[model samples]
Target: MTAQHPSDVDLFAPPRRSGPRPTTTGREIPHDQLDQFSPPRIRAALIGHATALPGVFTGPSQVSEPASLALRLHDPRGRWEAFLYPSPDEFGHIHRTGFMHLTVPRPIIAPLIEAGWIEPHPITLRPQWPDTIVMLYAPRDEDELALATAIMDASWQQATES
Candidate 1:
C-alpha cells in the first residue's frame, strides 16, 4: 500500500442542480430580536440531524449595517462553519431568503449540494469577516409556526423536568 498525503484529496466539485428554485415570502427577523421569542432553539435542535441547519450568532450591540452572524452546519463530508448576515440593510438577505450560504472551502460545496443544504447563490466577501458566506432560508409559514411552537414546548418541558 502507498501512503497518501492529506493534500492529495480533490476538494471542489460542481454543485448538483436543485429542483424548482426555492421561493421566499420576504419575511424576516433579526437574530438578536429572536431572543425575545425564546431564542432559536428550534433551529438549534436540528444540529444533530443528518443535514444540519446553522445557528444564529449574536453580538453585544444591536446589529447595524454590515453585521454578520457565525453559523455551524454538518454535512456528510464534515462540519462547516459559516456566517449569515441578519442586518436589515445590504446584509438583510436573510430577511428575503430565510436562509444564507456560509461558504465552505471549494471542496465542501459538493457535500453541501449533495446533502440538499445549499445551492449556488450570489457570492460576496465581507472585508471584516473574510471566511463567511451567507444564505437566507424562506420565511416561515403558519404550519411552520405551529410546528416550531410544539417543538419548543416539548423541549422546554423536557428541560424543566430534567
Candidate 2:
C-alpha cells in the first residue's frame, strides 16, 4: 500500500485473534458492548486512567448515544490517521461493558488483535469508521487489568509518540 493509504496496507493481515472472539452486534450507532462487563470498581479505575491521560477530557459523546462516556483529545497527534470523525478526534471511550474504543496505530494492530486483546470496531467497514479504530475488550480481572494498562500505554505511545 502507498504511504498515502498507509492504513490500507496489511490492515487485516494477521496471526489472527487468539481464542474466542467476543460477541458484537456489528452495529455502529448501537455498538453492542453489553457482555463481559467490567466490575464497577474496575470500570471506575479504567475511567480514571483514561481521564488522566494528557490532552484528554471526559464527557458525553458528541456522536454516540446518550450517556456514553467518551474521551476527546485536546490536540490529537493524528498519528492514527487524520480520518474524519463525527466529532473531533477521540482518543478512546470506555463502555458499560468495560470495553474501550481507541484510535490505535496500524502497525501494532495485528499483534494486538492476534493476541486477542482487541478487535475492529463494529462498523469499521463504513467509510468513516476505518479499521484504525479498534475495540479493546474489558479487562476481566487484575491480571487482565494489568494487560489492559499496558495495552493502553502501547496505544497511547503509538498515538502520541509515533
Candidate 3:
C-alpha cells in the first residue's frame, strides 16, 4: 500500500491559495478600496487611528501567510500589537467576506466570542496563537470598529506592559 500524502487528505480544511490574498474579491483592492469589504469609512478610521498611536507601526503582517497584505501593528518594544486583515472563508474568497482578524488577550476573548463580535481562531490553522487570538467579525459601523479598536489597544497594552 502506498503512503497517503498530507495534501491528499483533509477535505474539510480551508483551501489555501497562492499569491497575496486579496483584500476584496480574488484581486487586490487599491488602498482607497479598504472600505468595500467592510465598513469603508470605519475601516479607514480604524487604520488611521492605529497608525497615529505612538510606537505603533503599520505594515504588512510579518507572521501571516506569504504575500498577505495585512496591516500589522507593532508596539514600541518591537512586539506585535495586533494584525488586521480580511478574513477569508473556507473556500478562499477574500472579497466581500466583511470579516477581519485580530490578535488580542485571552481574558477578553470569551466576551467577544459570546457577544458574536468575534470567533475563536481555528486551532488547526493557528496552533501558535490558539488562546491569544480572535477573528473580529465584519465591523459594519463605527460602533463595531470602536470595539475592535479597543481590543487592539488592549493587545498593545498587554504586550507592552507585560
Candidate 4:
C-alpha cells in the first residue's frame, strides 16, 4: 500500500442499505465484481471524480488481472491502506463488473458489511492480511453512485491521512 485512493467516500454517511445484496462471486485471485455493475457512463463518472482527488493517480493495477486501471494515493494514515481497483477490463479481466477493492479501517469494516455495502476480501481470510481488505459493490444507479463515491472518499482519506 504505497498510498492513493479517491472520490468523496464518506464511509458512514447513511443508514444501512436496503434489499438484498448484489450477487458477488470470486473469492480467490480474480475476485468477481458481478451483478448490477455500473454502465460505462456511470463508471466514467466515478473514475472522473476519483481521479480528480488530490494525490490520487490512475495507473495499471499491481494486484488485479490485466487491463485493470487502479487508483492509488501518495501516502497513508497507516500500513497498506491505499490503492483501489475500481473497475476491470471487459475482455482481459475476470471481473467485468465495475466494483472496487480497497482497504479500510477495521472499525468501519463491520458497519460497512452490516450495511450491505461490502464483503470481506478473501485476502482477509488469511492470517497474514488484516481484516481491512473489502470488495465494494458497483453502483448501478445515481443513488448507489453517490454512496460508492463517498466510500471511495473514506478509503482515500484512510490512505492519505495527513
Candidate 5:
C-alpha cells in the first residue's frame, strides 16, 4: 500500500444537488407549498374551569399548568390546586447565559389578591421554563381568568408573528 499525504484527502466537498430545481427560477420548490402544511389540531381542554369577573378581558386560549411543577394557591381560608404546561420558549429563556425572571404587572396581581384568587404566595419558579406562572381560581373571579387568557393570547400572537 502506498502512503497518502493528509493534504491529498478530500475532507470537504460542495453539497450535492439531489432534487429538481425550477426551470425558470432555478430555485428548489418547497415541499410544504405542494402539500399544504397541516397538522392535527390538538387542544388543551380545561379540566377545572375558572371564570374571570365582569369587565375583565378574555383573550383566546386556556391556561394549563406546566408538567414540571404543580401550583397550589392559598388564601386565609383555604388552598386551590392548579397544574402547569410550560411553552418551549420558556425553556429557551432558562437556558440562556443568565437567570431570567419575569415580573407580572402589579395592576394584574393586586386585583386577584383582593378578590381572593391568590394571596401573597412566593413566586413559584417556572419549572424548567422560568418565564411563566400558574394559579387555580374560584368561580367568577374574572380578573385572574383574564390575566391567564392574556398570557396565552400573547404567546399565540408571538408564535404567529414568527
Candidate 6:
C-alpha cells in the first residue's frame, strides 16, 4: 500500500455539463434586487431600526468577528438600556449567521423561546441568565421576520420601561 498525501484526495468533483448552459433573458437584473431579504440585508434593516431609537448608538463590536456590529442604548439615568449584537456559539465563537443577542429582561426571554420565535442561548442552554440569553432567529421567512420584529420591540420596551 502506498501512503497518500492529503492533497491527493479529491474532495470535490467538477461540475459535469450535460447540455448547453441556459442563458438569461435580455432584461438586466440588479444585484441587490436578487435576494433582497438576504441575511446581510435583514441585518442592515435591524441596525437601521435600532439606531433610530432615542440615545441608541451603533458601533463595531469589540468581540472581533469579521463584519460584526453592535448597538447600545443608554437611558437618562446613566445606565445601559439594552445591548444588541450577533449571538455567539457556546465556545464564544461567532460566525456571520443571522442569529442575534439582545440583553433584555428575563421575563421577555421565556415566551419568545417557547413560541419558537427564538431558541435559548446555545452557550447557556437556558432562557434565563447570569449572562443575558442569546437569541437564535432567522429572518428568512415572513413569519420569522414578524417574530424577530416582535422580539426586537419587546426588547426595546424592556430597555426603556424602567
Query: Clash totals for all models, in order?
Result: 14, 0, 2, 9, 9, 0
lDDT winner: 2
**Positional deviation of residue 139's Cα in model 4 after best superposition, in angstroms:** 0.5
List per-prediction Cα lDDT, in the order shown: 0.30, 0.65, 0.44, 0.64, 0.23, 0.41
lDDT of 5 by residue, 18-134 (tens): 223212211211101121111211011111111121212222222221221111222111111111223222211110111111222334444533443322222343234222232
Across residues 1-162, which tens digit of lDDT does each residue of candidate 4 receive? 111222344465445666788876657676776577778877777788778778767666666865665675554344443433332211011133568877666777888888888888887677655566788887666677777777766666666664
A best-first ranking of the candidates according to their TM-score comes to: 4, 2, 3, 6, 1, 5
TM-scores, all models, native as reference: 0.30, 0.75, 0.56, 0.78, 0.24, 0.53
lDDT-based ranking? 2, 4, 3, 6, 1, 5
Worst 10 residues of 1 by lDDT: 88-97
Report the candidate with higher lDDT, 4 versus 6: 4
Error of 5 at 90 (Å): 2.1
How many clashes would you count in candidate 5? 9
Better of 2 and 4 by lDDT: 2
Deviation from native of the Cα of residue 65 in model 2, angstroms = 2.1
User: Candidate 6: where is the Cα deviation over 4 Å?
Assistant: 1-38, 63-66, 76-95, 122-131
lDDT, candidate 6, 1-162, per-residue tens = 122222342212211212322221212111011212327666555556566666655555543343445544545222232433232211111124444555545565555544444444443433333344444344553334444544555555555664
Off by over 4 Å in 2: 1-19, 79-84
Q: Where is model 3 more than 4 Å wrong at Cα?
A: 1-37, 65-98, 124-127
Please write out the lDDT profile of model 1 over residues 86-105, one tens digit for every residue: 32211112221233323344
